[model samples]
Target: MEINELTEPERRVWEAFPRGAAVDLTGAPEREIRARVLRSLLLTAPTEDGEIAGLRLLGARVTGELDLQYGLIPCAVTLWDCDFERTPRLYGAEFRQLNLSKSRLPALWAATLRVDGVLRLTDCRIPGPVALAGARIAGALFMDRAVLGTESDGSQEWRDRAGRALQLDHATIGDDLWGPHLTVFGKARLDGATVTGVVQLDSARFHHPSDTALDAETLAVGTDLHAMRMRVEGRLNLRGATIPGQLNLAFARLANPGGVALRASGCTAGEFWMREAAPVEGALNLRRARFDLLHIAPEVWPGEVRTDGLTYTALAPVLPAADRLALPLRDPDGYVPYAYEQLTASYRRIGDDAAARTVQLAKQRRHRTTLPLYGRLWGHLQDVTVGYGFRPMRAAGWLLGLLLLGALVYGLHHPRPLKADEAPAFNALAYSLDLLLPIVDFGQERAYTPAGAYQWLSYLLIAAGWILATTFVAGVNRAVNRP
Candidate 1:
């Protein structure tokens, strides 16, 4: 395209491309620029001596599809506050940087696109899906305050793509994905995506009530995934994700009634901060998830939480045993022993032995419900005597009470000696001790025999002693053998 044949507005952009000068078309009558002319200039425009050439246009009405598929753009391309007549196609294209900030577009199809520098779509209004699947971005990708997707048009295609407002499936971002205050009318899918830096989606709003709002399953992030104060109308699925840094969801509002609100099963994070968040309207599934520190408020937990196989090294705010027990106690799938064990282990890791023992006692109490009638009876005996081995002092109390009772009964009525020559002193306390201790022989019980009703009292004392011994031994064995 010769300079003389170009339109006045086109000539200005063409001349400014070599020097990387901005051609602001705001409030100008002639704002229309052909996408083909811009593409041609980007591919063949000559740069000034020692000057980096870039096309920086502002407030232009770009007509026709900007099809740069498989093209290698030499210079950075920035078209801020521009209006696109159709969706730009950049599939398999390579660029140094690409910024379309504050632009109004029908959609953006940049699947398999490669960028050496940052890609900014900040504050853009895109009414259709933005596909970035398989994109490799060296620098951060910013979509802050960007609105993607519109209400359904009632078509089958629209319905099928309803949950996919922004698709970055399998994409690899070398730097952060900054999208604070973003609004996605559908799902923001990042399945199998990898980010080398933090992913900030703080204060973002995702609306896809019937399906997943943010599907980042199997995503691997190098740093924190900050979605603080974010609002999601559907499930926030992070299943199998590995975030080495914190996954902060403070003050987030997640809603998916009767379904999984936050499905993060098998996820691994350093710290999971969910304090001060709204009570989830549905089940919070963290099954098999592992975290170094889990910071959550006790009152903020939903009615249902699936914590089977979940393991956290520490818990924040240091809640009591009863407050922490609410997690496993409210598990929809009943009798998950692993959940209680993990909680007990967390308490133990924090050096809260009392809380750990409390959790262990609660676990035994919960397990009692799943036993047979005889097993439940046995469990009740163990609980009353020793608190299922968690409360060791209870066993001592039972022993003392039984010993005192036995001594009091036998003291008032001295038993007749079976053999006067072989009998030891008739000490009531010594006789009671000998009767209570099955293995210890003071010879007082063996030498003397009670008569009449006193004989029945002796039998009762022997039976109680045996029962107490059995319970004590069982509790001690359980506590000693437990890991």
Candidate 2:
């Protein structure tokens, strides 16, 4: 429709749009664009060149509350370079398209808003928080190169009140949410979000030290979530999040020393790419985390990685026994049995039973080393007796030692035979054998009773036999029950 054919309010909003063959709104007046006028134009705007001729209120200072709660806005809205006296209230509103680029707003409360097209806020200055909780954007939400919160003036008040710079809790985006090079002062809340496309936060800077800087707990991203080179001053909470694609965090710097730097408990990802990244200073909790592939060296695995329940299908370059055990052995809170169990299972999954056994043995040895003096002594005894229930050959070695000692004693003593009817072919080896094997009595003990040192030797042989028999049974049971 022509400008003259429009209603008076519609004409005013249309006049705010730059009038030229080449439409550019770089010099519009700071006219007060009320919510009613914008709403009217959105509901009844004419089409131009197959596009909903959007009301471009460029350089205008929009006033009043734009309360479109539950209202479906029909036309595209572009308010470029505009200054808002108050942030628009578009809670639960549905928009065809929205572009508030280069605009200055106090805050944005667009929770549960539905955008069919792009929600562009590039280079915009938002002094306060931007709440997008439960929002559903069919297209991308672009906030590239934007300034999320105001710069700190060394004021403790502003620092203390910085709760969330951008809230995206439970939001579902059909396409990507690009926010590269953005600066956020507080947490970027993305808990429970389902992004069908990538959530790229490359080179973003977050400054919320000692607390969560980016909380993406339980988020499910259909594709890769790239946060490469992003700098987080506080913790990056990804607990229980699932990424069907790779999670790229190469060169990212996370600093929350001695606290939780990254909590990724119960996370499942297709591939994890953190090769050559800056080390996280604090604890990196990875309990129950499952990944198909890991793109990290055993040496480069963070010193504070808590891997009590971590499992991976394969390592990019499979490491040796020493390297594979390094990360789990660095658990500051002491030895976690499940951590070794997880490594053993991962190795077993890849058909590396030797590596799995190595992990199990390392676990036992470490446990023994950390025990009390008497406990360590008992553990050594168990090792010699049953090979900690893994080495049955050690039991045979003990049995052989006892047999030799008994035969030497019998040969030296030359004990007299108790039975006169027994045959004269007396063999020392046969006598030792009869004493050692308690189940089979070959009349050797009944036939002769040793004297002096020979008597003590027989007692020693009988006790050693009983010990070895019980330990052998236990070792076999352990081997059978193991998975």
Candidate 3:
């Protein structure tokens, strides 16, 4: 089709161009007409070897959208580059098939344009300040190594495209959105830049988190999402970047002392690089982060750990100094915990015998108040103390006399089994058992005087009688006359 066969408005737009080696459309207005011209080019784009068609759009806003998809007869023209050296324009405006990978775009013309089309920039490079700030579109906008913005005074912002929210609603692509090492001196807003594709940034270093995301609900500020530290360079500054989705920060270095290098507060993703990094002053909020516990640092516990690797689990107070007998442990069924059992366990682990004893008494006292078992148990103990404790302790004196009489009779008759110089077994248990049996069953013999035999018998009988009287019953007369 010859150029004149085009629509009148299309022809008027075509006439607006200087038909030279590279047609110049530098001074076109940002009106609907300019949009129409770009749309025409999109529908009937040039191909082939010759540049029929160089369009130097110094300044124009081509806002028309044409659904020019693939198979729309690729116009064979050697459209190598565009020269908007001083113009800010949207040249090859497309709404569908946009493969402008090798187009030489105008540099630093200071324009804010929107390409509401699928921008397939495979190796496309652009120079200057681009403002696609709040532009919303439903296509993939590719800028792989496609530089935006000058490293001048704006060396601290990502204005190469626009202010924020560079929306890419489900822009599916075969290759990664590779822009690893590009520095956006300002914020690069790709808030919901949803891509059903692998977006690879082998070593792309973001300057700061504050200016990097649009709504940036999924960028880690405490940590960088890097592929073995290659997708990043220099110090990363993500102060409050919120990652609402999965953020893989594996092997990324963090530099902030107390401030978190990446703040993935509510992120939902794979393994993160939170280990062996600098301390964080900000929160490493993985509150509801569905991260594998194994991926998290071994030091990272259930509660928040201080940036220094100290977890709350390690700070349990030294099991309270004493038992809480006065306290009650009521379950949903209103049954109190066994006080005695709790104390026993607590004291065993504490390894304090004194405290253990105290806990025991408190438990016993509490048990007596609440449970029925204590009455029988304590009463039994008290009775035993009176019968065995005092009796065994008191009769020790008279029993010694009776024991002496028996020892004398046995010793005199049997003599020493072997001489007093006999050897003893060295086993501690055996030795202890020997000494214990004697102490339990007998007492020491009295010092012998050998007064006459008659006298000896008489004294022995009296001692025996006394021992029996004490063991059978305390003398009524003696007790009544005592006080």
Candidate 4:
């Protein structure tokens, strides 16, 4: 189009494109600029060969849809603080860079879009879905403070389907994907996405109650995935995700009652930090997940947690074994042995043998509940006598108590001698020791036989000695054989 035939706003934009200059029309009367006019200017070259060419327009209302599907724009396109009449269609399109920051758009249909540089959508209010599925960006994708999707439109079909507000499935970003302070009303799906840099979602709010709020299953992040202070009304599913760096969710508030609040099964991360986070209303599913270091506060632990097969190299804050034992105790799956084993292994790895023993003892106590009546009775005997071998001092205490009781009883009465010539002495302590020691015999127990109640006391002493010996031996055997 000729400059002479162009509208005043179009002519000014055309004049500024050749020099890559920004035309700021903030607070000016809204002038309608056709999308085709902007496209034509982007396709045109500058009159001078040495001059740079790019389109930078600010605060203008685009009349028609900026349909650049399958088109290759060589120059950067930046339209800040502008209004789009319709959703911009950039499906299968390639651009040097695209910045639509602070723009008001109904939606963005940019599936399969490729950008050599950053794609900025900061602070934009998009009431509809932003589809970036299969997109490949060489630089960072920034959507800080952007608000995507409106409140439910009262459409049951959409709610049932769990309509996505922002879709980045299979989208690959060379640098970070930053969306701090972002708000989405529906599911924000990033399944199969790969980010070379951090995926920061600090203070973001996602509301998709009774369904998944953020589904990033199979996501591969080269660095950290920081979602500190984030608030989610539904589940945040990160199953099968791989993060080489930390997965920090400090101070996050997640609520999905009767369902999983955070489902990270099979996830692998260098560090997982949830310190000082608010109490989760639902269960936390970390089954089969592995982390180098897990830093979580016990006060924030929910009642129901599924941690079977979960492993972590170490735990933070260096809590005592008794305090940290609550983690495995909170497992909703009814005494998951693997959960206790993993916790024990974690403490062992940190060189806390005492803590490891505490976890193992707790494991035995928990496992007792799942046993039959007979097994449970045996377990109770072992537990009281030797603390399942974890507390060996209990055995010594029981031995001392039994020995003192037997001596006192036998000292009160004298037993009749089997033969007057065979009896050496009537020593109560000696006779008690003889009855208690089954493997070794003292001459006093055989030389004199107790009669009536005194005889019953000898039998009681013999039975008590055998029970204590058996229980101590069994507890020792169990401790030695444990893996």
Candidate maximizing TM-score? 1
Model 3, span 347-456: residue lDDT tens: 55545544444455454444455546767586455334323222433444444445465445434543222333443322322322222233331111221222356345
Q: Which ten residues in a row have the lowest lDDT in candidate 2?
A: 16-25
- Candidate 4 lDDT over residue span 29-142, tens digit each: 757789888777766645446777888989999988888889888889999999999889999999999999999998999999999999999999998889999999999999
Q: Give the TM-score (vs. native) of candidate 2.
A: 0.77
TM-score to native of every candidate shown: 0.93, 0.77, 0.39, 0.90
> What does candidate 1 score on TM?
0.93
Per-candidate Cα lDDT values, in order, are 0.89, 0.78, 0.37, 0.88
Give per-residue CA lDDT, model 1, range 201-257, as digits (tens). 999999887679899999999999999999998889999999999999999999999
- Worst lDDT run of 10 residues, candidate 3, spans 306-315
Instruction: Kindly report which residue pairs in candidate 1 clash with one another.
Output: 163-187
Error of 3 at 70 (Å): 18
Give each model's clash number: 1, 0, 42, 0
CA error at residue 68 for candidate 3, angstroms: 12
Better of 3 and 4 by TM-score: 4
Regions of model 3 farther than 4 Å from truth: 1-40, 43-81, 86-94, 102-118, 122-141, 152-176, 180-183, 209-215, 218-247, 254-260, 273-284, 293-483
Answer with 1 or 3, whichever has the higher TM-score: 1
Candidate 2 deviation (Cα RMSD): 5.0
